[model samples]
Target: MAGHATVPSSPEPSSLRALPPSAKLVVKTLEYEGRLTQAELVESTRLPDRTVRYALRELEDEDLVTSRISFADARQRVYSLTTAES
Candidate 1:
């Protein structure tokens, strides 16, 4: 924990207000589903591939989500809400 930076315990309304609707949907999906891959997010959120990708990038920029390589498939990445945001 030494080198890790702490985020606010709750999301800031101003920040969330600035995000696109797709990004908000992605966040809600992750919150409900725990964690999911890009494909899963698309399935769960009914969002297009490109939109999911864009949303993920936006979430990452806000430090609201983090990604890790899937253990079952090296080619896939799974995403989840960060502890602070979760």
Candidate 2:
């Protein structure tokens, strides 16, 4: 019988290290919930509004998350993990 090759079971350390703890939390929330508004993200992460906004901005800059005006309320903005990140 031929032996099967073993596959790596974990993500690269560099990839994990690149994300800050808050960013990780935000990503996880978005991934689990599909889509969320900025307020919702703040609630979900239990983070301060400034922290949530900072994380969202960093994620957006990294192309990890995308945002657009909410159809239900133009005054509000919705956010979600990008397809590549998801």
Q: What are the per-model numbers of colliding residue pairs?
A: 0, 0
Ten residues in a row with the worst lDDT in model 1? 4-13
lDDT of 1 by residue, 46-84 (tens): 989999999999989998889999998999999988864
> Which residue pairs clash within candidate 1?
none
lDDT of 2 by residue, 4-71 (tens): 43322323345446777897788778777767898999999999989989888887887778898999
What's the CA error at residue 41 for candidate 1, in Å? 0.2
Predicted structure 2, TM vs. truth = 0.76
Number of the top TM-score candidate? 1
Top-lDDT structure, candidate number: 1
TM-score per prediction, in order, is 0.82, 0.76
**Which residue pairs clash within candidate 2?**
none
